[model samples]
Target chain A: MRVLCCVKRVPAPGAKINITADGQDVDTAHLGFAMSPHEECAVEEAVQLCERFDGEATVLTLGPPEAEEQLRYAASLGVQKAVLLSTDGSSWDPQRTASAIASAIETLEAADGPFDLILFGNESADSGGYQVGIRAAHALGRPIVNAIKGIEPDLDAGTATAKREIDGGFELYNLPMPAVMGVKEGLNLPRYPTMRGRLASKKIEVSVMQAEADEGGQTRVTLKQPAETVSNTVKLGNGPEAAPAIVDLFEELGLL
Target chain B: MADILVLAETEDGAVVPATLEALTAARQLDGDVHVLLCGDSVDADDAAERLGEYGASTVHVGESDLLNVFGPEAWGQALALAIEEISPDVVLASGTSKGNEVLAMAAARLDLPFVANCTELPSELADDDEVELTRVQWGGSLLEQSQLSAETRIVSIAHHALEAESAGGSAAATETIDMEIDDLYARTQVVGREMAEAGVTLATAPIVFGGGRAVGSAEAFAPLEECASLMGGRVGCSRAVTNNGWRPHRDQVGQTGTRIAPELYVASGISGAIQHWVGAMASKQILAINTDPEANMVVKADYFVEGDLHQVIPAVAEEIKKRKA
Candidate 1:
């Protein structure tokens, strides 16, 4: 039951996101890079599945050479294999990203047997286009389900049941093996890399694959940060003393 | 030159607000707006009647047995048929869970690029073929404007992105498209659903009373709940509350959680993070109660009461009781 999980290197943004000077991208000089939150969960889920099912787990990323840091980080958490589809670091449009990933999947599967499940973050932390995973799945001709919170594969039955959270309860989706799923955060709490595991990860070799992608139709115009929502706080008094004032405000609101 | 195709979703026998909002967004584009109505026993004429008021030019009624079940496979199959029968330049739907999934399914089947949660689209495509797009990224915290030069571009309009307005008067006519589905359409279907909250959801509540980590424990949420009900609102919590296991994820208000645009949001003990700010920003007014005078929620709120929530909350509740009595 081999599983493949995809992750992206994104800046760990602070409360306020700063746009580039030219407004073409996010300003990341002071920020640390981490895997997209959802993909972090995906990598964790893939490793857990391997622990439970007794199989190999591979973590892949399509980014610059520095992205190997994210790959190695996943390796620290028990991933047996790490593949870096190294790119030039500039943001690749969703189409090119999907094409390169699909081609890479085909190449890797040709050497080893196909994975039972392929995972992706529901959407990238930055671009959040919400289509790359589905596009990659389409290119591979596999059924893809996004926004999945829970997944359980029945190896004997060759089916995987996916749980998606909606406004109310969850929805169940059952698909066959060799399927792709877009996972969201909160699916599971990702574990930290242990001291022994961190030491082991440093010695592991990373396989870096060049990403050859054709320029897609979509080109990025300038990226502008939407204006900040301005708010001014009017003191409604303080502590127990503010109770009457709040009640008065509530009365003004007709709540009382 | 091509028509704008809208997948008009229906709930409780009426056009959902999101779909109506999508129709409004469609009006921004060039050419006539043709809506694809995918449902069983749907009143094509009736829907066309209401939607015509909102600017639907032609209603394509897609009736099929496969439409009866809510599955991406079947929904995608039905929509793919509509897309093939009428090749529209741009496709739009509401950015609800169902809307995004079904369009993604159809896009996958058609082998096209589908954009999700678009806030703005070009009124007209460029002569060079690149369709301009501005979509919400990281929930509403940021916007990304890009281009999709596909022969056909699929998009889902973000909820509440556009104010829905009636164009006043029905369009010309309705066309019926009967669909033929295969067994593979049943590969994945929704077996059942259980409503998380029977009534008063976080987003729909008139007044949203939220709590944070400072609220202490799950059992301690009782006073907040009582206050919320008294104010005719519902109880919501911050991600910290959810992470701390004091509240369910559904009651969370944050970038990834449900965005609430209520008339008022009364947040207690919440040091608002940017993620939570994005969700609460849409509220008409915000009031924060926190021990720290400079908490993010306090600074961003319209009203602030610096105090301990455990004491302040009960005090506020008791004050209301005394005032009413």
Candidate 2:
């Protein structure tokens, strides 16, 4: 069955992030970009499903024109097609973002047959709104499940068995076909692209579509740098010789 | 005052602390707070007693077989019915796991905007239907100030953001709402579970001993684990350790992983990346053991021991053992 995976280009996760001077956005002067870890796994899962089911994998992303770079990366790993929902570099509120994506999916399906499975990262690594996938699912009138860690497609039954992580174990959901899922990062270990694959990715043409996002009900006022927390760490000696001191430290905290 | 609706998450026979925290937040949005309690065979009196402590103006209890099993679709449907009848101006819940899913489901059912992981309440300066708020982005690493305008605002309160407090009042009115549970909603019910051993889990651990990429190997975690067990805590790791195949992803503590708030977080070999700091910053006390004193984790920690974790871990464990003996 054909699969569609949604990916987002986010600042590489790590280090303290600085807000831009305007306070309306993140300062990305020294930052690099990568697909969110969760979406990376979603792309990998979509590719794997295509490999097993003898279908094509289409990767879509909503970001600036530079997002084509992420689309190409996905193409390098065997994605058959790449679509860029190109927009202004500014972020969209979840309400508008979800509708824009739903519209794009409908436009794609009008030409191509419907996708059997659509995947989204559980949440964006940057904004982390945790609403777009569910909102899109609702807008498209499809059954959607979120926080999926494991998935088993029942081709015979025309259903998808999705497992979401809970506190102790997992909660399983049997969703009908043409389903949507919000997958987490640990769903799979993404495979690296080979030299030949990278070369093929360079030649793949990216289909760019302008995403006319409506001004939704939500608006970002400004970004605030979180208050810095200072910790005055008392050095408890050094090396293994400090082990006894460490024990004393634990005792002082009553953690013994 | 606007009428606020809170999805009360219950545990055992009482309400979860997070729900109380949600009620605490709801009280601020408006004093007219209503709570929707959904579950099977829920002890209404017990829940109402606890909820009343947090200034719940009304508790709407929805009991049904569909809610007997844990599923967001059915729960959200039930909550939707309650919302329609209660007609509250805003809906609130906690930000992780069940609370996140159920509110998202309800948002979809109603086709409304649902904001998740809110860290701060909005300013009352703009007196209108629209509310100005600040929410967590990058799992608390960054905060985004936003303005949300809707007939009904649905929000999922971020964990550890608001402290749960009681208004110190008696129980308010309790209303039993009629629930219409459909088979379609219950169609995707949970078939099974894999419950972990009782106690000492990362979320509720009193102390947490964590390692990072510098810890070297999976076997290297043995000493840290021993130290954690001795201290009645759990052993956690950074995403780097899981990436290096030295530890499982479940042991990771970061924005993308578990947000841990323990009595103390004793971390070694970790550089205290922003993502990890977001999760570990909630700890009451933090201690870092790293060779580089200038490391991010060391600089942020409340206590430090500059050394190789491989040598320091076992020595500390041995010292604890010796002291106990």
Q: Which candidate should be chosen as best, given DockQ against the real structure?
A: 2
> Candidate 2: RMSD over Cα atoms?
2.1
DockQ of 1: 0.51
Off by over 4 Å in 2: B11-14, B39-41, B123-127
TM-score for each predicted model, relative to the true structure: 0.91, 0.95
Give me the runs in candidate 1 sitting further than 4 Å from their true place. Answer: B11-14, B39-41, B126-128, B180-182, B213-223, B229-232
Per-residue accuracy of model 1 over B26-143 as CA lDDT, tens digit each: 8877767888887664677788888888988899888777676566667777888898989888888988867887787788678677778888767654122566788887677788
Name the candidate that leads on TM-score.
2
Cα lDDT of model 2 by residue, B152-246, tens digit: 78888897788999899698678887788887766566766656677767877989999988888898789998998888899998877876767
Docking class for candidate 2: medium
lDDT of 1 by residue, A1-256 (tens): 8999999998877577778898888899888888987898899999999999998999999999999999989999999899999998998987789889999999999999898999999887778777778778878878777788888999999999998887656778888888999998777767889997798789878888999878765677767677766677899887878988988877777656
lDDT tens digits by residue: candidate 2, A36-138:
8789889999999999999899999999999999999999999999999999888798878888999999999999989999999999988988878888887
lDDT of 1 at A154: 96
